[model samples]
Target: MSTRRYPHSSVSPEEFHKWLSTLICVLNSVYFVLNMITLQKLGLGTMQLAVATFAGFCLYKSSNGFYRPWHSYALLISLTINILLSIAVMDLVAGATYWGLALPFWYYSLFGLRKGFIFSAIIVLSAAMVIFFRTDTQVFMPYRTIFNFTLVYCSIWLVCHIYEVQRQKTSEFLHSLALQDDLTNLKNRHALKADFQAFQHSFESMHMLIIDIDHFKNINDKYGHDIGDSVLIKVADALMQSIHTKEIYRLGGEEFVILFKNINDKEAFRQAEKVRKAVELGIFFSHNEPIKLTVSIGISSLRPEHEFTDFLRAADQKLYQAKREGRNRVCA
Candidate 1:
């Protein structure tokens, strides 16, 4: 909704899914062929064929732009099952046990921290159990096998876990940077659009107030840009204190927007008037010298057929009307 691209990867998620699905299909198909020709393991080859078919289907859907959440889930689950089954039927040494070690990375990348942890834990524990119980004691000591397998599995899991945690933190930090106003420390226009999308379907009635500082250029021209920035910061602080709702955003230099959900026209205007009065009366300082400021607010109500840009345009038109009539009043 925010339109923030993934900071860490060049490829989109859909593209990544398609690529991964294709790789899975190809690798499984190769494995299936090898099992049939070289290994002569009928059951194992059949299972590989089944997994390859499923992965191929997933790839087909993704390439046609029909991907879903369950596609990833189903693929991962099937792969895990096939790996576990191979180890169970063929024993630890002969059966693709090494494949199990990569499960944690796959799970963490696809499912994220919590679900990844649960899924990885289940696979690791299940594999450990199979090795501990079914491993041939004459060829390999059960405890030693279990110990080596688990130690390696845990080390991989820990690395995946740490990487996922850091990835999440970096993502959150980048998202905030994308949506936040650097100067005023308020939500920016991108954030406002994102919030509008979230509220549009859930609320039957919503209102927007677009507030502009009157003759903002005059302040910058008279006192300088630094002083003007200080005034803007003070105004932002005033709006934060005066508005009961937390849906305030700065729509770039000298303009701000506030959103109200499930509110009627009358209450919306009342809230806008209150904000205007607060800004008018509040003391703003530049180098400890008091400066006076006023904001003109324009109000618009959400219409069912209106998209975010349309909604914003309507309020912006009202804002222009307010500016034409006078500089310090509310217009609807």
Candidate 2:
């Protein structure tokens, strides 16, 4: 078993799934043992034991982020096994069919909306078929049993559906908060780092530009912070309009970063110049007076031996050079 910790917190869905898988393994093992000892139903018992062992191994591997490629399919397979077992044991065990009731919750949590609903339907239908066809099972009020089962299963499905919808909304809200800048509505530095780190190994070549506004402090000092904010907003708008790609980040204050994917050094420098010119040409008005704004940009392309920090530092150095040489220009 691998001991490596995956990139998921204790509260994350992956961690929750891991714990759930572990629980399933233990519970299934116990059920299998009990069925084997008392009922001696060799087929059901053996199948349950097999499922238990599979769940256990998958849990171990997935928790440590090892061999996780089959994890999703494993979930579906485990649920199918349990559903079959539940139907098969309905006649032998008292209230065995009730075991299928929890299927909705697990499906929704593990597979998400569409697949969850589908699995839930399959479980419900399988249980119903067993009840309808296997009339040899000793039970009273057959119509009432069918009615109540259908109603209860439908209720469970509806509840799980609503819960998953809300969970998805909350997840999306949190994800946006983590990645988006509150002021400019652009992605923030945290988002930039996360994205770059995840995709750095995959991208063969890329370009980065660090942009800074010229004498931004003077604008804040001369016109007040309100006007300074307006300047930043306008500048952000200009940059957004100039770039065709979504890999733009607001690095706080007056600094912004743009990442160009699969672009060479010459093309990167050309894009930086184009953005600088766009910002210079953009017109902004403050207190009925037109203000001309310009930005200095430093461009750097990924090198064969560059780490993320090295690439960023190269861009920063070039930005400094641009500022020193003269504002309103691009440096490489």
Candidate 3:
């Protein structure tokens, strides 16, 4: 799977929580008002309706606070209140269809699908036995009441499943896009930054190398941009084949970076030199023809107290210095 950028798509779990919380508020508010008004008009009983109404109001308040760190206790208390209230007006004959249906969706949102299904199955079956089976009055139905109930319940479940799948797919796609480089099929810089930060905190010694393809603009100028792109891809492929896949990235234009974690200065420098020689010695094929090319590499490592980017900057400066000395070499 690969990630591609699209507007309004967020990959982070924190962002998703905000969206889900807001959506829950909107849905509960609209349904709560309509259900409260309709249930009161039905003359099911006022005390039960009053309690349910109060619970709905509380749910509206607590669920709407998106900034509050998610704790199951607050939501669980509200859900218990709502469930108890739902039981108050429960009946087989024309109680509240939406009220029953809302619980499954609420469960789905909070606890994930399998758990949601289990909880929903328990709630609905309890309602059927204690409320539906026990009541003499008949619930509203089409020509065939049993058939209609099955159809409606199945449809509701299917819709919930579809929403869950779509959300999961969109989120997965968004994540892939954020981490990948479209041009070279390597990780993008943002992903590189995060990786560097993680490695920085976890490891006392981390090595960073910045590799820039020599005279890339000249290649683009001599050949077409497409051939130049092919050259970049070849260089990236060489790096991938020569080193660990997880550590490589295409940092924009002809520049690529690698971070070797838990490796000391000597081994890291050795690895970078190996990659630099491999890239320099390799013959790149652009349009089925061999083209000679080389890459300049600068290697640096994190000091006891240095920002992650600073360590990389040392390598970057050395890479330019390599160009000054001559294009096809490694500098550390």
Candidate 4:
């Protein structure tokens, strides 16, 4: 099944979960202590207290370590349990049942737009059922109470939904600005560094090729900066079309890099050569005149001992070698 995408944040969802989990644990501890000290005055029983303690422990446990995608599932299960407990205690407890009101915010915050909405609906329906039966004990008349509760809860959900949707869009926009080149709309160095760090531990091997435009300064000097920008955009389009499995980065100025995953040196060289030829033969127009350009590429394969910086340095050294040997060529 397809899922809705949420806003991108510099702070990852896992980090958010961890921090929120800690917050929940703290709040649960406070509630647990209050219940114990108050001696059943708030209508909290041993079972409710036990569940609160367990939930606190689980949330605290889930907050530590690298983010596992399944962590949210555990959180969701914990929340479901809490909702059920809240409903079970509603008839006995006067003010305690209102814990269900917080469910909408928690659901939408943790799960994003679509799944969060479904979970929120379930909690609301479950709470409504309990309130429907227990209306005699409630202060307000039955229908009025239900109506007000439903209206207020739905309004809160709607506000949270709109806020989250906007937050998601903002996140996506920020993420794009952070990782993407403004000129070519390709991945930038920051994205490359982030991916390299994430992969360096597990990946056995990787290939990199650094492509530099030949006489790039001369092109800008003769044709002005407008044509130079156009050249970069067209070259980016060509690279995007030529590569399938690899990612392309415009690593500032007229330099670009392509990262090839799990590829051999010979295959990497072939790919680099293909990119060089594609750019060389690719046509560009400047003021109705043809503008021709070529790129020099340097290729490197990852070594077990090499860090990202070392691997990048090796590729950059080779790129300079290609430029030194001749203008449009590949060097390894």
Top of the candidates by TM-score: 1
Q: After superposition, how far is residue 212 of candidate 3 from its true place, in Å?
A: 0.8
Off by over 4 Å in 2: 1-10, 62-72, 137-143
lDDT of 1 by residue, 60-149 (tens): 998998988798898989899888887877755564789899899888777778988999899988998887777555777778877888
TM-score (all chains, Cα) for each model: 0.93, 0.88, 0.73, 0.80
Query: How much is 106 displaced in model 4, in angstroms?
Result: 2.0
Tens-digit lDDT track of model 2 for 1-332: 11112322215556667777787788778878878898787777787788778888878887778746357467657656675666655463467767677888877876777878888888788777766665654665556676788889889999998888887777666677778887788888878787677667778888899999998898889888999888888888889898798888899999999999888888898899889999889887789888888899999888878878898999999999999997889999
Ranking according to lDDT, highest score first: 1, 2, 4, 3
Candidate 4 minimal-lDDT segment of 10 residues: 1-10
lDDT of each: 0.87, 0.79, 0.66, 0.76
Worst lDDT window (10 residues) for model 2? 1-10
How displaced is residue 215 in candidate 4, in Å? 1.0
Candidate 4 stretches greater than 4 Å from native: 1-43, 51-93, 135-143, 201-204
Winning model by lDDT:
1
In Å, residue 325's CA in model 4 sits off its true spot by 1.1
Please give the RMSD to the true structure for each candidate, in Å: 2.3, 4.3, 5.6, 4.3
**Native-to-model Cα distance after best TM-score fit, residue 290 in candidate 1, in Å:** 0.4
Candidate order, TM-score descending:
1, 2, 4, 3
List pairs with backbone clashes in candidate 4: 7-168
Model 4: residue 72 alpha-carbon error in angstroms: 7.5
